[model samples]
Target chain A: MERKSSDRKARAPSGAAVQKIELTEALYRALFFEWAEHGFSALSLERVAARAGAGKAAIYRRWPGKLQFADEAVNALGLKMAAFGDKGSLEADIRAFHRRLRIVFRHPVVRKILPDIYAEAARSDEMKAISDRVAQTRRDEAKKVIDRAISRGELPEAIDRDIALDFLPSSIYWRMVVIKSSLSEAQLRLHAQGTTAALKSLW
Target chain B: MERKSSDRKARAPSGAAVQKIELTEALYRALFFEWAEHGFSALSLERVAARAGAGKAAIYRRWPGKLQFADEAVNALGLKMAAFGDKGSLEADIRAFHRRLRIVFRHPVVRKILPDIYAEAARSDEMKAISDRVAQTRRDEAKKVIDRAISRGELPEAIDRDIALDFLPSSIYWRMVVIKSSLSEAQLRLHAQGTTAALKSLW
Candidate 1:
């Protein structure tokens, strides 16, 4: 039995590797809950490992320190840009985008995590850079949607893309996070229509 | 000398009242710096009094507790709406408003205090409500700008006023606080133009 165990350790079985991946994911999940509740400044790695029901060595082996852990855990949450598809018309594309935004912002985890992240970003320059990168990535993806609309002759070539890119997310975030308004679906639809109308004129 | 002092106190002298007011203002000022640097959760009334060279009892007399002190100190900072003074066209009025916004946001106290306030707001529902009230007050003031433009025939009366009121500040806050981007005068001018153009179309 000892010889067989030694052989397995030497072979590094796929089962062990899969188990390690699961452990890492569990650690990240625990970290998210901890962060959402306590924020970055108050977070403890020991608490995270304990909450994850994993050993401290497991966390240390994955991340060198707290900041990297925070960055990775937040990145793992995956706030990627939504694929609105080719909605054909600019208004339709924007409405689809808004619909996706409403869903994303309304997610239980996203709602809790976002405010904490924003608060963390406000306090730390490193976190701010990470947030800016995330925003830029989303902006780049949104630019594609606008580009498609422009190619379809739905938008003017001279449309100020930079300002337009900032508008949608900014407005949604302002309403959802800052104002903490409980926007009904109809209200969200009206916002989408109003924004689309404004974009059409500007573009 | 004690009799003379007692007689003076009985008279309720204006000079004594002025000195007391000065001390109260000084304490609030110190509290602002402390809150800005350390944040609300970490703020200490003792430290504020010490910084202001005032008595702890004085602070206690003015505010029942740290939260009220923080609220009153922040409110006293006066983020009042800018008086754009009817710049004739919507674009010009927006430009003046933008200029004032730039100054207010760039103020050292505002720059530091705003992030801390946001961080606190994320943590506390009370802070969130205070922030919302401040935003609503500013929005009410901003509505007058649009009302004036509508009256002047510069913007259409049919415009969705609610969304437009949210747009300017949301965009500015997104750029300044979330993205942490520095805006040049030229960029501000472009933003002002884009927003005005959008409003024109929406209205």
Candidate 2:
């Protein structure tokens, strides 16, 4: 009685659908690898398909072009970020956020891919929209952390959410993203704790 | 009489050399504009030369090729940064830094070109060297700030320089560059004041 195939197979994919999903996952893996190695300007669909051991038609069936492919892939990252959950206290929540960000930043492909995304966003309106969407999702997630802290009375009711948002995640980002450096465990804890103190100044 | 004409213009440039210097400046300006508009991957030397109202010979006279042109221009930026002097206090110094960075980031051409530079750094060793040189210069400047603070007893003798470095400049950069937004004067003041408190947490 299901109208479209979308809801029907999402819960339990049959044999061929499972195979197709696996193939799609392979294509994504290959796409990111090639993009990392060559930079975004040189991303090749043929190479991605060949590396994935899939036909070009497989990509076309999923995405009309490279831009569509990339947009969808980056859009899927929102789900990756949504995996973050509440960690009870403000410090714990901020620490969890930094740890998760560090894991994503530590992935070599991701390190290579992020600057390209920023460069692409600068060049094209389409890429700008994708970049904005990714940022908005992160902010939405960040808001949840701030909201929980305020409710817990760790933060005051009159806090500047924008400034608090900046305080919550920026130091680690500047360290990992701008400096292209990894943080030791102690330093990560310091970022969590230090910012927990600093965020209070926002009020 | 002087060695290779390099010392000839130590004091002054007169005649055709003056004209040549102006043309070279124009070429640098045009090169950055084209790079900002088209991105590093699509940067075109021919377009740059034409936009400057110069010929291909003008470019060849300055450098061997596009890579050399870009490298030299980026290297010249070290002089731009060297213009920053000590502001006599830690917070004033950081506020000056943020003000300088804001001016740079606000430049339409610079805003467009920076991400491409980062992306290029990721993809090419030559670019990585250039990027590292720029970061090294900034760190050297940052170190001067921390040292001044330590001497003034604003910070302790045993502060963690690396984490302190992260604390000083990141919040504004994260707000400006990563989120791609501007800040108000009070918010800038708050960043300086807040970090003055936060940097002590590293000790």
lDDT of 2 by residue, B74-105 (tens): 76544245437778887788777777666666
What tens-digit string does per-residue lDDT give for candidate 1 at B1-203?
Answer: 12333565779856574237678789989998776555566677889999999889888866678877777666777776556578888878777777777777776667656655655576677777666655665676568778888999987878767667766567667766666667788777766776676566553
- Which portions of model 1 miss their true places by more than 4 Å? A1-30, A43-62, A154-160, A197-203, B1-38, B42-64, B153-160, B200-203
For A1-203, candidate 2 gives per-residue lDDT tens digits of 11223554676676535236677778888888888777676678999999999899888877778887887776554424544777999989988887877777777777777877877787788888877776675677789889999999998998878788888778887788667788999999988877877776565
True-contact fraction per candidate equals 0.24, 0.54
Considering only N, C-alpha and C atoms within 3 Å, which residue pairs clash in candidate 1?
A: B159-B203
Q: Tell me how far the alpha carbon of residue A108 in candidate 2 is from the true structure, in angstroms, after superposition.
A: 1.1
Alpha-carbon lDDT, every model: 0.69, 0.76
lDDT of 2 at A50: 97
Task: List the candidate 2 regions with Cα displacement exceeding 4 Å.
Answer: A1-23, A53-61, A76-79, A82-85, B1-19, B53-57, B77-79, B82-89
